[model samples]
Target: MSRVSDVYLIAHVEDDVGEAVVTGALEAAGVLGKGPGQIKQHHLLCCSTLDGKVPIVRQLEPELHVDGHSGSIDELKRFLPHLLLVREGHTSAASGQTNVGIAASLASYFGL
Candidate 1:
């Protein structure tokens, strides 16, 4: 197989329905293909954490407002694999919360 030229890591904090919807969309868009020269898509389920099942959507809880802690703490841990790629120079960048943001990131990666 050819080396992957790009990889999209999705670390969404949602229930099964949401995951299924996202997967269906990705698959329909051909982003989930695993062929020789396709951009790879990695799906991560983010409902587990050291702090127990801290649903990422609840990161804004007042009780979770600890110093040196941001809302993305759990997300960071969940997406650590993708972050490692950036750190190791395998990925250029990782930033996105919406389709537009993700599209912009991808465009930047491809010099579009």
Candidate 2:
């Protein structure tokens, strides 16, 4: 099998249909994540191709009030344009949600 290095972006969907879309995108792009089990809150993951680096972007729920957090979605939106988006679903963060997106983008951008 040949593995082509490519950046991956992930976003969490609210419904089964959304999940299907995201999962299909990730699988097609060869991107994987920490899985849903490790996700205590809602978030998204974007990854670059060169070195398999990942960054996690937390999606705030109205209740979590993630906007109040140090790094909110608004902050992330500022950087979204620079990233290649992908979709993924898993059961745990251990699968690679925390740092996949940032790593992937940096790697691809720097040609690492």
For all candidates in order, the CA lDDT equals 0.39, 0.34
Q: Give the TM-score of candidate 1.
A: 0.38
lDDT of 1 by residue, 3-60 (tens): 5333333345457777677777767876666765554555323342334333433432
lDDT of 2 by residue, 1-112 (tens): 0132222234445566776777666556544444332221223443332222223432321211111122333344444333222222321121133322332233343455
In model 2, the worst 10-residue window by lDDT is 61-70
lDDT of 1: 0.39
Clashing pairs for model 1 are: none
TM-score of each: 0.38, 0.26
Which residues of candidate 2, in runs, are more than 4 Å off?
A: 1-10, 33-105, 108-111
The alpha-carbon RMSD values of the candidates against the true structure, listed in the order shown, are 11.6, 14.5
